[model samples]
Target chain A: MTDAVSARERILARVRAAVANAPEAAAVARDYRTSHTADDPAAVLGLLHENLADYRAHVHRTAPDGLAALVAERLAERGARSVAVPPGLPDAWLAATDAVRRPDEPRLSPYALDGIDAVVTGCALAIAETGTIVLDGGPGQGRRALTLVPDLHVCVVLAPEQVVASVPLALPRLDPGRPLTWISGPSATSDIELDRVEGVHGPRTLEVILVTGG
Target chain B: MGMPSFPEAAREAVGDTTLRANLRHATHTIRDKRARAVAELDDWAALREAGKRIKDDTLRHLDTYLVRLEAAVTAAGGTVHWAADAAEANRIVTALVRATGETEVVKVKSMATQEIGLNEHLEAEGIAAYETDLAELIVQLGEDRPSHILVPAIHRNRAEIRDIFAEKMGSWGRPAPDGLSDTPAELAEAARLHLREKFLRAKVGISGANFMVAETGTLVVVESEGNGRMCLTLPETLISVVGIEKVVPSWRDLEVFLQTLPRSSTAERMNPYTSMWTGTTDEDGPSAFHLVLLDNGRTDALADEVGRQALRCIRCSACLNVCPVYERAGGHAYGSVYPGPIGAILTPQLRGTSSEIDASLPYASSLCGACYEVCPVAIDIPEVLVHLRERVAEEGGKGHRLEKAAIKAASWVLDRPNTLAAVERLASATRKVHPKRLPGPGARQWSDHRDLPELPAEPFRDWWRKNRP
Candidate 1:
């Protein structure tokens, strides 16, 4: 066997030994059941909506063709004037809106991003069961900071790209060398008295754009 | 520094009624909120199980995963340094800061950094380290060590915080507003203003990670306040010191932890700001990023089979909130950067049960199993505590030897029932002369608080012989 294969085998053997010796391994392994059940894109999107609402995150859906229009109209409704746009954002996505589009640049400071009215980016991956959108700084996702700084963030999730799967399945798709941010919901906290407060540090408003029939 | 003895520290903590009241109220509130937040999701149990499995699996193959992580991080234009101990870690970090020619560095609340006393070390090297996290800032300004993991200033009430702010906020940068009151909003405002100035001026930033993904070489930090974001993004150079055990196998594995950690800790469904970065991005955030992979006592901790599981802790502080002993003793009594149940097990293992403090830490818990029930990673804290008690008994030598001799004599006597009966009769004859309290010096402390059970007039064995047995 090659050295790499030998190393892999050795590591796997050690892991097997460790697991066998672990006091509660059998019990824990039996409890970890795969939960993915959505059949198609529409099913996945539906699950996302259910889970998001369950987590108290505001969710919005629209047709693929009407996405830009819907996003523009949503931005307008929210009184957003300048939207931070990721570098790989589709130009046509923002074409319908008259709001000033601020391209996400490398040197942009948190203060600058805070000044922008809103941020729009494409997700690297989305887990439907948890209503989580992961931004990996890949293509339209831009830098992690861009999505974080602004008070309002609108994330675009393509129907087929998002999955209703377990973390084990999603593991293979992600690159280890990318800046990955997994966001379940908008930033929030509860004080010492158990009073829940939203938008303590990250974005106050998180609007999910589910582009269907893509 | 070594952990102090648990019984002595706990005795001191138990006597402070005010501290006890504060801790009881604070911990109970967080524990209830955490329970409610976790209960909201039906899949919380599954998520917790998944988290435990992932962490266990990753830790099992930690060496391989760490190498993979290093390669990934190096490929992504980041440098990874391995430090076998705290001194090594501090040296590497101070060297990095010195190389940058910066006199001051802004810091995120990193448990690893605190574990090694990096700030004090940095100060000794003539470099100033400013804590940017609000709780840490309060700790630094007040010249106090953190007592609680999540809320370091948890022991201090709002009025104390207001006083700390009013007195120290100006020296840092921005002063507390003219009429700073003991209100959350006012304190938060003062902290925000004070930290903003430091964030803008600092040339370097230091931090710790909640999780480091090996597959992607991505470092993740989840925080409630925006201070971490500022410290991470504002500095020209970023340095993160993270424990080796913090590495997860993959980004997907992060899902399990992300779900369980927030609800268990800060009682949030999700933290406000979860910052993740791979490496240096051209002109985005910090141009330079360096990761210090700290081992310190981890390899030593990993050596023991039963004791190693303490490493799986994500520093969520859930154990602290639920600990009855920690609720009384507070954080300062523990002496180590880690406090409470997790601290009681972890500190001794890391530092060894050599000192008065380290030796005593194992006995700090009531072994109520509340900590085990709430632990996200399912660390059997009571099991570890008992195991450490054995270790301490072995280390102490005198007690174990005496106990062994007494056990041997009892066994011999039990082997001969007639002799046992005779001895029991003699004990009953001498019962009137026996004192209620133990006669020994140390025995007084135990008897002072608790009454020794009265010896029966007739031995149980004698009664059994006379009756049906």
Candidate 2:
């Protein structure tokens, strides 16, 4: 069997030879709009709320002080017995919740996390145009598994500050080194006769809390 | 070992009424939804143009970008292995799985892996590979080939899918619950339960990336189901077999595709999940990451300036949905893992026009240009089809033998106006007695589905002379 080192050299040589006589392609013209909607923060916030709900995510709004109560209420409504909390999640965020808090210092195993009822975490950012919430394994957002294994994901997006108008605006602000998961709605599949069916492998129910006015 | 020609395969598929009904319902539903989704953006034209340019630029300097990507992935603590062909890629992956001492692997739906036939290769090596996506799971359970790029089981309706699950799930791992129904929700739930056990225990995971950012060494997988997340995050070792053409120059280049891909594919503003990870991180996700760069027939494809534009495809399957021929003939007729308009052009170029299926693929289209219109990257599929048709003609394949004969016969008759007129009059006189279909081997296949045109009572010249005089 040919080794990898020679394989690399041969493949690159073939690629160079393939395009040797080809015309030089023109430079990319990026005249596309950075944001589809208006620049106003309030309008962007409203679009985020509208689009997220359009994909069937439950959307709510609360003040900074009312956040703990809203989180607790959503978890209680799901009847969650335990919630996986990321390491840097604020204590005040889950203070009012009656569900047991399973911290991730030791890092929950896939089986252990499977048994947990829900996961609550903060986000790196959210895109208004696409209705996507991005988690980059940040302080409050645990590893990728934390949000994946649980049936219910209650993600808190700090409005205006954590929200952007479009995908183009969202990429530069993110760090590429960390693992990123961009979720628009709860897990969905159009596999069955091309009809949209929500609740597949990821969180079946995604509840977004847009906390405003600290 | 000659495969049936495209016309032969398509004729068999077109005759299946159940398959036609399943395809029509699925394609029509997604076509309208995709149109509405794309209509929401005002600068869609500009985005399409930009997407085309970015892909073109990447292809032109693919060697440099690939080298840069290798350096970045290695710098970020990921091992990069290069494969010149399918056999080498299979060997590399089999060795990786063997080194880990794992007999089973969970797979996310990937066209590259399907192209390489990775599952069968591993199974031959005494390893069991489980497909995790809901659509892929259905195809695997049914012992069928993928019919669509996005929804592999598009040909299987709800009832067929439920039946496949009810019968086949047990032998694979988990059994479907008693009394399975035809509803989409219940079937999806059954898949979720059946795969959850494998997700939690698998030691090795395999996948293909939608886009690999050369700048940051980040591999991105865009998917709707959470099965992708499970196969990606839970496994201790992750192996991604990516085509060499899947590279982009910068991290920010994802903006264009991140916006256009979802709308074109699933007709959603965004898919439910899009995962991007650069190599491996400490105590997060996979502990060991391997990036296998595959160039199986890709370098050959890049040689043709006109055909190389096919490499720009993002695998949106929009072309498949809009194509009229694809609507009736179905995807399996394309005789490739890639199906539809994109496949017609792509398969022939990658594999060449030597085989019967590959030669016939170039002629599969009516060239209505719907695939070109719906293409997000603006691949101009018709131009490639025509180009490949020329190659097929030059290469001298079986399908074109009758084509050349007919053209020769036509020129001979047209050389003499007297013979042409006499022949026309003869055809006119025999109009009632003329057969609906032609006779002979290749000619019969052509006339089987098409009716010969109704002949006029007299030639046009006779009518012109009689009236004018």
Candidate 3:
């Protein structure tokens, strides 16, 4: 099976090469400038907060020590009985919370995940410019579905990891062969009449926990 | 089924007043909302410029980005398959499904799947591919091809949709409740109940991503309905078929697109559901994940220096909404899975300007610039249309031959002053005996809808000499 797959891959590679070389449209160059300072992480975090708020995502901040407690308290305030945690989530982060902990399991179905009140996971990276959080199915990220099926999701971001950059700079960090999810904010839509509706596909509520001053 | 001639299919759509009304209303509503939503952002122009630049740069450095993306995804424990065309893509997906031993799959709304005719091919293999999007479900139940890009069932009104539900909902599973009304809530409820059953029972899911981040090896899908979320997460084995061009340079790059796509497409500030996934995880979601990066005609599209701009399209359908011809003629007229201005240029380029319908598509538009103004990527659709018209004329032997003959005859007569004067004299002398309409074997039908200009007492040149010269 691997051999056949390789053969098919080889054929497709040749086809792509041919298509790429075909004479068609000329490329148009676009010019745009950005005013982001990459040197300062705080500046990046500030941009992230601004963008997140712009997208209507709720933002909260705390020192590393108070991070988990804040998340737990927020969940409790929302009346969440159980919160879904990714496999690699830090145990210390949830130590302050008395809420029922539901670790994300492979066998858990969509129906099962739907039963969870909320989900919490650490992000692979956060882009401040666009107010986007990226999960690369990493340790605490779990599968894409777990984050998507639940109504509420709490994404934890370490301040230093935030990048105040363009897409070209971020591309080198991602793996093309893995399942990677990029989230801007909570799911939302507008009807034909332009009435905005939130939480149609993934989480209806998104709370970003930016742990700063480590 | 093989694609039929687009003009004939379009002729039928054009005649259907109800379908036209539905499409006009739906498209206009979305278009207006998008304008308003886009207006709320002061940096929208800058964002659009950034999105366009990123896409262009990515396409330019696609080889590097794709390699980087593949390495990242593989490193993260995901499998990636490259498919050259529709047949290859379908074969890969079918094999993946077969390996999972799943005969039925639930699908999110994916234009890539439609472009490749994935459902029909899967059905041929005795695999049932259920469309989970409400609009897509209507199209599948009605056994019809989608007319609109975003709203696949835009041609259908509430009443027609209710009838489709009444007749076809039961056979698929989860019959519509008795005495279903055409109200939006009831219709949504019926579809919700129907899809929930499929989401639970299906073991495999198929989807297409709006963007694939090369940096993180992540795939993203933006949808309004929760169905896409269900399809992405519910199944144990998930397969995503994406056009190779869907790739972006990085996660940060996605921000620019997320802002522009929703407003340009559904005319919203944000999509209701934006789902992203990278690779498989040990204890969450689908155990096995497969990414099928399909080139199909995109590489061909990319190769064209003038035509490659079409690749910049986010498939927002903004161009379709503002197009005057599309408003009256509907989507089916352009043919292929893609329709309107984008389809006119894209389908022909992908398939080649060989077929009669494809050749005709270049001429379908009125060369209006509306499509360009509304295009988020700023594709000069009219410019492309004219460019394609030249290509068609060059390739269309019969049309070229007749045009050449007509031009040669006109040149011979005009080149000589005596010949022109004599002809004018002869025409005027015979004016009284001339037919009230155009003469000749080929011109009878042409003059039916038009009046033959009254013959001047003297020719224009003759009058000019007598009056002015």
The candidate scoring highest on lDDT is 2
lDDT of 1 by residue, A1-214 (tens): 2533443344334444544444543323425444555457667668777766665567888778898898898789889999998888988788788889888665466677768898888887777655677777877778767876676888888877665454445546766555556677765444322334455455667888887777
Q: Identify the superior model by TM-score, candidate 1 or candidate 3.
A: 1
Clashes of each: 11, 0, 32
For model 2, how does the per-residue alpha-carbon lDDT over A46-101 read when each residue is reduced to its tens digit? 99999999999999999999999999999999999899999899999999999999
Q: TM-score of every model?
A: 0.82, 0.93, 0.76
TM-score of chain B of 1: 0.90
Q: What C-alpha lDDT do the candidate models reach, one value each? A: 0.78, 0.94, 0.77
Could you report the DockQ of all the candidates, in the order they appear?
0.23, 0.88, 0.21
The candidate 1 chain B region of ten consecutive residues with least summed lDDT is: B396-405
Off by over 4 Å in 1: A1-31, A36-81, A91-99, A105-107, A128-131, A157-173, A189-196, A209-214, B1-5, B15-18, B37-62, B200-202, B250-252, B281-284, B397-469
Give lDDT tens digits, candidate 3, residues B78-172.
79888877898999999999999889999998999999999999999999999988778888999987877887777787888899998999998
Name the regions of candidate 2 deviating beyond 4 angstroms. Answer: B405-469
lDDT of 2: 0.94
Order the candidates by DockQ, highest first — what do you get?
A: 2, 1, 3
